[model samples]
Target: MSSATTYESTSSGHMCDMDRTPIRHAEAIAARNERDEVYAKEAKARELLRITKRKAEKTKLALRIAEDKVYKYRQALFLSWTVLGVYFVFSTVFGGHGHMQLHLP
Candidate 1:
């Protein structure tokens, strides 16, 4: 028999024919190309997700540093105010004790 008309018989007495048509080969190639395109798109999406996660982590670190600086500045301001208040009280109570002997002619 010619190659075009060749068929193989299965163990169950079924004839299996090979498809040698150009249209069938073209369809298979198109299906494979579509699968490759889908995989490429998935890879691009994963890359973008990784980049976004890195940026988010950097932003979070910067925010944490800024918050720490603000907290330290607040503590320093509170301490400065406490010291100033204590000095003011001491000066008001003792500033005139040593100047009581002033006389006017």
Candidate 2:
């Protein structure tokens, strides 16, 4: 038997036989390389997905903060409008009071 026709026992109680041509080994190596490349692409995709998810979460949090700010300022906005309306009314009613005031004759 040639050196190329070697046999070894595997840990799983199986026999690893290397017989015939050396092209089989080359083919196996190529297959393994292809698998590794696929795994690398999968890892990169997962990393990108993680980054996108984080960005989405940040955007959602920012939106929530903005919503909370709007909610917190709701009363202030209403109060400002109310004050403006009251000022307009008061100015209309009392604007002539100052102009009509006369000095003692």
For model 1, residues 1-105, the per-residue Cα lDDT tens digits are 764466666577665546445667898999999999999999999999999999999999999999999999999999999999987777678884355567879
User: Lowest summed-lDDT stretch of 10 residues in model 2?
Assistant: 13-22
Per-residue error at 91 for model 2, in Å?
5.3
TM-score, cand. 2 vs. native: 0.61
Which model scores highest in lDDT?
Answer: 1
